[model samples]
Target: MALTPFLVLGFCWLPYYKTSLVFKLCHSVSEAQQRKMGHSNVWNSHPKNYGPGSRTCRVCGNPHGLIRKYGIMCCRQCFRSNAKEIGFIKYR
Candidate 1:
């Protein structure tokens, strides 16, 4: 009967102990191995010119374009007219 409480406590603590052991094992790995494992610093790949607000078209300045065609926010009319300039080769 006294062992019942101890068994309950051991079961509850088992997961926490295992988690700490796994973290310690990961931390013991060398930096070179971590790099080879593809662990990269996220900040290194961050955009240089990130900003708030939705991106707008460089030419017409419309926000609700059908799609970001040719990397610019442009409506259907503007996109068709400037498709060649924007680097999209028309089929017809």
Candidate 2:
């Protein structure tokens, strides 16, 4: 009967659909975890009590001239590297 072909098609597609859904869910979960870890790493990497206009890089601890960018005191080099964390993009 016609129902037999329809049933076979559904059965063949079911597993592939279920597997794709599971993979997407797992990928999202892992991405969330990675974002959490990246935030923690950024927080721990910066220095403490270091305000703007300080002559030191909060990230690399380089005792040199620093500029205030995105409310954090860091040298030009460090600032360029950490621009993404401060919601800015690094252009080459």
Candidate 3:
């Protein structure tokens, strides 16, 4: 238990390191990772909303995404206008 962090650090710093094994297996994004990471929305062209004011809409709280681009991680009801302005184009 005491050596867990060290072991994890070593794995991350290894020359042959690929993706983080724990993240891939657990499929959980830690708060530290969220800054540098964004989920792939390849299939979710029109992401279905679970509902408004939900915790899952955390991105809406971001002043940058909302003020500058209005590109919050919010549902269609909340983000529809700017989503059009943002001009999302599917390439792949």
Q: Candidate 2 residues 2-50, lDDT tens each?
A: 1211111222423334455454433222445546756986875655555
**How does each model score on TM-score?**
0.32, 0.33, 0.19
Clashing pairs in 2: none
lDDT of each model, Cα atoms only? Answer: 0.52, 0.55, 0.41
Off by over 4 Å in 3: 1-72, 89-92
Deviation in Å, model 3, residue 51 alpha carbon? 14
- 1 versus 3: better TM-score goes to: 1
Candidates in descending lDDT order: 2, 1, 3
Residue 6 error, candidate 2, Å: 99
Model 1: per-residue Cα lDDT over 1-92, one tens digit each: 11211111222423334555454433333445545545455545655554323555666776555456455667677888988896889677
Residue 26's lDDT within candidate 2 is 32
Number of residue pairs clashing in candidate 1, backbone atoms closer than 3 angstroms, sequence gap of 3 or more or interchain: 0
**Alpha-carbon runs more than 4 Å astray in model 2:** 1-54, 90-92
lDDT computed for candidate 1:
0.52
